[model samples]
Target: MKKWKAVLTALLATGMLTGCLGNGGGSTLNSESSRIYVTEEGTFQTATVESYVQQDYYNGDELKTFLEEAVSQYNGANGQNQVTLDSCTLDNGTAKMMFHYASPDALIGFTTQYEDKENQVESIAVDKLSEVYGQSESEGVTFIKADGKKADQKAVSKRGESQTVVVTSANPVTIQTQGRILFVSDNVVIKDSHTVQTTKGKSYIIFK
Candidate 1:
């Protein structure tokens, strides 16, 4: 799979409800008005790497505009061709909306390829492994107790620093798994949450 898609896919798969971005991995957004407008708080870390895809570039306005408008339109009238907004909350000074949009064909193709694999990625589930991070489950991946660990699959984080906990084991089983949890705090607030990864025939369970 392409790099961008992989990152985006991971982000989508994790099912993070909501979060905005700042200079660091943990950034905050603040809003004073009852309703906050469109703003891509964090860097387009995942989407930027994907080919033929730009973070916020449309005919004129940025992709943020399109996303906000799309979300507003969808909220006004629930119908087809509308992306789903999983969560909406205020963080710092920004009003963030965690949402899911139709992934491009290239991404879909990559997903299909991985899905076709015998034990590639059938399903993923999350359990509250700790106060911060969560436990992830999949075919090859096994659940192990970890305090709070973050690894980077991409260069998103030079050290692969993440707020989520995911483990991969090299036992007889061969599977890929990822786990994530979205929360809000004074330091790092998770405005919303959504799925990180899910295939057509796959399912992910989350333990509160």
Candidate 2:
């Protein structure tokens, strides 16, 4: 009886330790706290990336105009198009823009040209409506798929030396990292779901 009791106590202690370690593994990227606005005028939605820094990276009005112009151009060229800017906001430490398209093909067309345009500001944009899952790596960015495939992806250029990670996907994703800057171009639904933290240079999540 004495030996059995000792074994049970040891097992319980091990379980507790495992639970604590599991909880400390990764951080969540929640999109609920971001400032999101939706409107029928052009069927547009806008959201700002919630960040530790309060300073605005891009002029909101200017970005709105840019997106509006892009939509006009796309509509003029395509006769059967329904793609529109879903949201544009500054989150994390970078600028991010998202667009909604009627189909995957439409998204492809817009990404080809809009992504190549020369601009004074550095920002990330999604060609189609997507849900991005990302985690910061010490060397660069790492993306993981729902089926456990490591995705090969790169970040959009930044104005400064700081590195940025951009991940776009149609399905929800899981991220594992210590902490890094990320700018998402789609609606983000944090896997585990946690509060957004705003400490300069600390780990946090921002959805655009």
Best by lDDT: 2
Compared with the true structure, model 2 gives a TM-score of 0.32
What tens-digit string does per-residue lDDT give for candidate 2 at 75-119?
788855556876655445444555555543454456445532211
Give lDDT: candidate 2, residue 55: 43
Tens digits of lDDT, candidate 1, 1-208 = 2443354345445533223222211122211111111112111111211112233311222334544564566545544433444444322333333333332222223323322121122222222334222212223222211222332323221221333322121211111112223221111222223122222332322211
lDDT of 1 at 22: 23
| lDDT per model vs. reference | 0.27, 0.35
Report the poorest 10 consecutive residues by lDDT, candidate 1: 42-51
Cα displacement (angstroms), candidate 2, residue 158, comes to 45
TM-score of each: 0.23, 0.32
